[model samples]
Target chain A: MAWEARSSPTGCINLLHGDARNSTSITVFDAKGIHTYQPGWLYVPFGEQDPHKLQRSERRLLQRDIALLSGDAGNVVRIDPAAKQLQTADGQTHAYDYLVLATGSRNAPEEVSGFAEGADHFYSEKASLALEKKLANFTGGRIVTGVASVPYRCPPAPLEFTFMLEASLRDRGLRGSTEIHYVFPINRPFPIQSVSDFVAPLLEERGVQVHTFFNTETIDPEHKIVSSLEGEDLPYDLLVLAPPHKGQQVIIDSGLGDRDGWIPTDHNTLRVKGYEDANLFAVGDATDLPVSKSGSAAHYEGHVVAETIAAEVQHRPIRELYHGRVACFLETGHGQATFLWFDYEHPPKPPKPRRLWHLEKAALNTFYWQLIPPGRV
Target chain B: MAATYQIDKTVDAKGQTCPMPVVMLAKAIKDLKPGQVLAVYATDPGAKKDIPAWANKTGNTLLETVEEPGLLTFYIKKA
Candidate 1:
């Protein structure tokens, strides 16, 4: 979305990645020290496929090489979460002086019965493509989606999937023949209560039957059946389950995680509570810090963490500090998007603000594209 | 009339937001030998505000800054 927005106006950034495989690669020995800061990219769904003018940022992606990816590359393995040493599957070792782990959260299949054991569970990338294939073969049938968890990654994603699926079905002219029902555990659409108050009416208007505030329990993959803790059996030909997301097992196993399996860190500084001398920080969805687990948190966290690294190098105190910030774009279907932004520093509880928070979610997307595409290192 | 720098080859981060022009200016000026100056013109509403503030933070001296009708002009002496 940021890339799309940046494409609207005009700009470019010079990106210097520490990974040499990255298109704009820069390498600096951690012991020696390095300090370079610029805005960066969070990959979006849009690519260069239009017949008309190609956006400058789109052109840049087309120009770059393959990325190793961040969270789910599967190449990176955890040696010891407490020790914070990562050994790649290819036998490479990296020891961080100051570590920032944005390993992100994973879903709990234990919350929903048989979801992990099924032949069609769509949790990771491998499962995603597998489900996509199943979707291709699926002609006219009932597709049921249920929320078994809350505070999931990309909070608006489930709804976005619904919208895109509806668009696809309608495009195939199977709307009448095919049935689609979305089950939400929350009574509201998503985000803050204020936005859900506005969107609940909208989701209902669009034919999405929302069952809010229901605590889900089980899914019998056989007989194409499901049952809530309330003993309601919702049958479906396909089940897109947003399972209960929890902290990584490695964190929990190594005692770095709380009871919720999340790493606890100071919300303001993003520093692990007892590990200040450890130079360890947690970002993205992994931290129990009071912020959304979206990539925006990781991106914002990267800025302050980068500053800390730079400051430690020059014997200078780290001036910049994290503000418990988060940003997100709610895709409203039909090419229109709503944006949101909030920081924890000001309010005791960040208000569910909507109607306009363009700087963090909307304009930042534009700014991100311009700055990340034509990076300045 | 103000001094115009078209930025023909490179280092033209016109119309960029906060922390970007700041990042770019730092990189551009660092490459200079000594006593070298780069004339930058930007249209972002925030760039006019950010450049001077970043200059103060990094110890780079902001020699002269001019705000014209539709453009922003900055003159910085590399420290």
Candidate 2:
């Protein structure tokens, strides 16, 4: 958003990317595995004929957008927020008037014991795809889905996966044979009380055992068991872990981020807290925004950051403040989805599962493909 | 038989997905004068429904539609 918004209106803008070729849709990644279980193509249903092709096309579109910036393709190896200077991998230094750090988050599977080596995580594109093979090979046994920590991107994903898995298992005539367990670090099924109230019964009705406050301490992958910090053990044939998440390493190296590598920012303004004079800002999963690190949150952050940058460029006061708007679709299995919309101020008011919401959720991929790379949204 | 209007621009939105066809069409149509026809060739299945919807919403008149193998074409007159 910063790249396109600042280019023609303000001045020549230079943009850099580590790799512009990869386009990740976490929601799609979650849904993609479902296709392997059943007779449906999530990508095709979502208007992405081929994900790799879509990625390449999106990269090309982004390259076209960045061409306006006149910036070279190089990975930013170092950032000095105070100095407003960045060093790229190609041995070049670029100075910026305003810096926007949107490095996003990465899976910290190592944070969980035995997770890095033993368990399969469905947070990343590659890992999520690998799960398809695991699911395909499974005959029937205990299937464990749980989170290693909170503040993971997309809070509702694990529960949604649970529903999809159950639906898939039922389709395969294995639902009765298999025992499904959903473990959460928090006491509740979801962060939002109302949504949890709405979904808890659905989970119970579907025979998914809910295990809360199960702080994942260690995974005995050898024994096929997950042990909690309190010494509670849950045995499983297959374990799907929602591993810990951390911000980009560059944020830590720049001395602009917290211990977890997430940049501390004014939640409303999105301005990096300490170095306000530097005009440094951050968005997405990289910021300590205290909101779901979902695409919708990032979209809201983008608007505020862009407005803040525009205001600074034009010598106007930055008035636009982010209200932490974010939305997610909970798949209730069998071609049904419910909309979960909330913000920092508002409690989650999720609509009931319906075909309309499912269609809207499917169409969002096309919206993402069209708007995000081009910096229009 | 109806008389064919002069075509001003044709946007090749093939291989591009849903909102992109409309997005590109919106951008292309903005450069056209009132009553000038803009044709868009799209391969995305969503465009068959989306283009007409977009045209209706934005007050543009969808003039013609042509369906061929692997592609759908739509002509819109700027309103």
Per-candidate RMSD vs. true structure? 22.0, 23.0
Highest-TM-score candidate: 2
Model 2, residue A120: distance off in Å is: 1.5
True contacts kept of each: 0.00, 0.00
**Clashing residue pairs found in predicted model 2:** none
Q: Whole-model Cα lDDT per candidate?
A: 0.53, 0.66
Itemize residue pairs with steric clashes in candidate 1. Answer: A2-A365, A6-A366, A12-A374, A13-A374, A13-A375, A14-A374, A14-A375, A14-A376, A186-A212, A187-A212
Displacement of the residue A149 alpha carbon in candidate 2, Å: 1.2
lDDT of 1 by residue, A1-377 (tens): 00101011111111212212222221111111111111111111112112112133233332243222222222344534356565544556655454555456776777567776642433444455556666677787887764665546665566656655665667667766777777654334453544566556656666666654333566677787766533356778887766677887656765677766778887767777677777676666787765666656666775665556556655677777888776666544444446556676442232333435423444555455445334321
User: Candidate 2 falls in which docking quality class?
Assistant: incorrect
Q: Write the per-residue lDDT of candidate 2 for residues A1-377, one digit (tens) a residue.
A: 22312101111121122112132111000101111111112322222234343342222344333422222323556778777777765576767676777667778988877987667766654666667678887889999986777657777777777887888889889998999999875455775668889899999999999986566778887898898643469999989877888877777887878778878888788888998888777777788876877767766777677666666555688777998888778878877889887877797877778988877776765555455544554
Model 2 reproduced share of reference interface contacts: 0.00
Cα deviation at A282, candidate 2, in Å, is 0.3
